[model samples]
Target: MALTGETSTQLALRDPDIRLMLRVRDDDAEAFAELVELYHHRLVTVMHHLVGNAEEAEDLAQEVFLRVYRGRKKYHPKAKFSTWLYTIANNLALNILRTRQRKPTIPLNVRDSGPLGPRPAEQLVLDRHAQPEDRIQQQELAAVVKQALETLNERQRIAVVLNKFEDMNYAEIAEVMGLTTKAVKSLLSRARDNLRVVLQDYIHMNEPGQERKDEG
Candidate 1:
């Protein structure tokens, strides 16, 4: 007999950190810190990749934990603890992105701190192998790839970040994004298309020609 998706998810909720969250719901302050310790780096990593700003991601990660603690009493183990933690993270990332959309601000960390995706800076580097003169600086390459990622809409960007950085599958991405798995599929499909379009020129490693020509 196959376990349904919901049942599988419910069963997965029995992981250690979910129990820790359950303890948090019972006023266990130590359990809460333990949860923070467990997820802080991972949360920061995902948020940083999502937003393209390391400092802001760190601040948002703290807020996510703080919000989780404040909502502890209402916490329920309906999903994996990581999933719930990332939900808080996802919301914060979205809000920050929205705020950034309204007012442009300089990003704190733009160096190799962008999307870790199926499409990544390293892949771009690989594509440049045939053109030794076209190799871009690592930072420049990351920034270019990041720019391509920014071409995606918010939903697609988030989906790509989770799928690539967090190693989450369609089901988990769907759970975090509050969408159906089918919707996640469509989002990824579209995101890849947009990335290919935005990155078409750079995909051939020809972008460095401009910088080299400038120096010449």
Candidate 2:
């Protein structure tokens, strides 16, 4: 059966796990397992982007789920399930990045590859075919962007991940991160400025005669 939005919402509303989660507040092992199955892959994907290593990302994702399972009794519906899930993910990723002694090695232009999904290069080519120089510049630009993201303060990085990648608005981001809307805006502003500076040369080189636009 295809998982359409309506069907997914209905499943969520009627999901034994969600209902189990309500029971989890009272301590239910079965419900916890259900939540695990539902969120594990998503959590792993988020962690991989933040932590930059599949093995570590998987470990971190497991830890997040473990925390949720252990803290089930304390679960509250102050936000959507996804927001709460991502909040835990964001915190864990930041902590991992903080405690590590070695800085993460930012990868250059590595395209996404999946068994069932279109390859990253294929997707890019389909969107826009470019000359060899353009391709090189694009890869360099992506590398700079990734490096710049690594340099953001933990909170700022989380904000950008949510805002840009997750397409969350300020209110949603604030709710997920437990910050005020104004604070979320400020964090994103600082992150954008930093990225602009870090990627200035790439932007200028790519745009040719155009002045670089301010990052929103």
Candidate 3:
């Protein structure tokens, strides 16, 4: 059968594992393990952005999952599954930031050499007619832009990450962060403005010359 939104949502809502989660409310062990497998990595990635360290992020993520398992019996479907999951992530991340008493830092110079590599700007330089020197300058400019994003407040940072990286729309971000759509838009607008200012030099420097345009 073709999946309709209602049907798909119902299936997830009444999923065997979610049903198992219902069982977990009654104190089922196996059901909890199933929940763990489903959300662990996703939770970790969200937390890593909030906490800014892989190890502490992983630890905090585990705690959030554990809270879910413990609270399963009381689980209610007031929101979508992902929404509820992100609510947990957001709360945990906020708590971590508050307790640690450290300002958020975005590491501009850090190269993405890991299994999952850098942002597109870092990985791809679209200089059609520029020489190698120009490409090097563009890469440095991209790094500065990335760093500026890091300096934004936590809400703005999260909003940018979800909207840009995860492709979430305004409503989805509002749901995830418990903000209004207007608020989400404001956050993104501010972030974009900050990024534009931070990368102004790069933008001006990289503008296509009239010769290049004429050729096209």
Candidate 4:
């Protein structure tokens, strides 16, 4: 459902991004450019993780911007601008993924690292001041975490990527993925469990210096 115009106006006053999007809706070229500049890298990173190919990710990110441009006239601040943006991204990525499922083929440029998140391995990277060996271990652990991420189903992966990388809460993730908050929580729980199982060997081999108890 669309937000009432007055509600959208209230949101636009609160969120600078929504204000910029409103400018875009008004055909302000510079506002659209600025919006693209701000979101380009973030959208690309997300698309790359979702599709598992850098090239495809770039194309998808471009497509997302194109969509925003095309839909400018109909823009409504129904939610945070970022949430609306990612909702588009999630839909596009899932469409591509579903297509792949129908006709499986070897992805030519599959990325090694999965979407980075605040898992135990990621916690190891929080210490900015680390020895060379520690950095190496962090890199290796990140790769392992990425691999573990690949073990999850697509919805689980999307939930994790948005929650971990985008720093979105469960409600935001739920909005992006078009799921209930309860469903989002369940999806994340299952994804975490799957990652724990996959990474158990690595975790045991290299126990984290400090346990991380944070969760969305």
Candidate 5:
């Protein structure tokens, strides 16, 4: 069962990472490293998907830690440790995207504009087919899906990534994005719609191929 607000707050207070963060507030260097060790890969992976580049994602993840360290003295358990961490990440990513928006060098959003209104294809490979994909095919499909993600507006991209990649629910995504759950739902709806259109050919390929007829 999901925890209630009070229970969640209480749990957050008791969480090991929260404890570690508390220690960090006391200038415990080891606590800082522990927090990084715990969240580094997860943050990097999520940021990588968001930014569509490993190097940028790594830089962003490090920045998150730096901000966390600097703000440790003011740390308060407003939410779970993970939720707080993601909030920082969300802010940094928005800044990067906004900067990109003003730059002529960066490619802007690549939305799928067509007649296809959305169907759920949040994770392209998983949603497109029921049969299991072999390693190579899955990798190829993942690359396509990653490209599809870049097409979304930044908010939708963040929402979809949190929902699909992190397995976060609408509420969690809302918290991370600082939006309402309803807003998160709308974002994900639009994102999935876009993904469906972009990956339409691949999805169709996953279906049983039509048999050839020998017409005489």
Candidate 6:
């Protein structure tokens, strides 16, 4: 449904990022810079997950910002600012994925700051007092999880990324992906199922009930 003008204004008032976006629409360079600073790392991280290459992710992230700046004059708050921003990122990431003939390989040494926070695989990271061997095990498990994420199809991966990393609900993810809320739910469900199968072996390595705590 199209948002009524009054509802749009209410959303804008409620979200500080929307207000910053409003400032950007007015050609406020500082506001644009602030928005870039706020989201640059996050966007790059997400793009890295999507494209599976640091260089391509960085370039794609910069392009997303550039598109934002170029289209600033047309900005309007139809939804949360992050939603609009991610919509752009999603479109770009999909384009990149579609153009590739083969799927990219995920690195074994995946970064600690991955999406889905500390699920079963991440839980392998014990306390600060953990021994070096344990830390190494944790890193290995995390990489396996990352590789599992890469196994998902593009749409499923995008849905999982937005839901887990961006903390978006089904409705928000649907808006970004141009799917119905039900479709987003289905996508995440399948993604969870796939991950569960791929990561089953590692789940036992974590403490009890660690896998059950997964959100989205």
Best by TM-score: 4
lDDT for each residue of candidate 4 in 1-216, tens digit (9 for 90 to 100): 224455777888988999999999999989999999999999999988877789999999999998999999998788889988998999998888888867766543334233444433444334333543454465565665665676677899999998888888998888888899999999999999877766655564355653343523
lDDT of each: 0.77, 0.67, 0.66, 0.79, 0.78, 0.78
Which one wins by lDDT: 3 or 6?
A: 6
Residue-wise C-alpha lDDT for candidate 2, range 173-202, written one tens digit per residue: 887788899999999999899777655545
**Could you give candidate 3's per-residue lDDT for residues 71-171 as a string of tens digits?**
67677555456566677777777666666646434443455544465643433333323443456454555455555665567787778777775567888
Most accurate candidate by lDDT: 4
TM for every model, in the order presented, reads 0.75, 0.64, 0.64, 0.76, 0.75, 0.76
Off by over 4 Å in 3: 1-20, 101-146, 200-216
List model 5 lDDT by residue over 1-216, tens digit each: 124565534765678888888889899999899999999999999999998889999999999999999988888776778888898999999999778757635432344223353322444434446553443365566677676877788899888888877889998888888889898888889889987887776674455452223323
What value does the lDDT take at residue 8 in candidate 1? 35
Worst 10 residues of 1 by lDDT: 1-10
- Name model 1 segments beyond 4 Å from true: 1-13, 107-135, 204-216
Between candidates 3 and 5, the one scoring higher on TM-score is 5
Q: Of the candidates numbered 3 and 4, which has the greater TM-score value?
A: 4
Q: What does candidate 1's lDDT look like per residue over 110-132, in tens digits?
A: 55344543334345545545563
Worst 10 residues of 2 by lDDT: 119-128
lDDT, candidate 4, at 163 = 85
- Which residue pairs show collisions in model 6? none
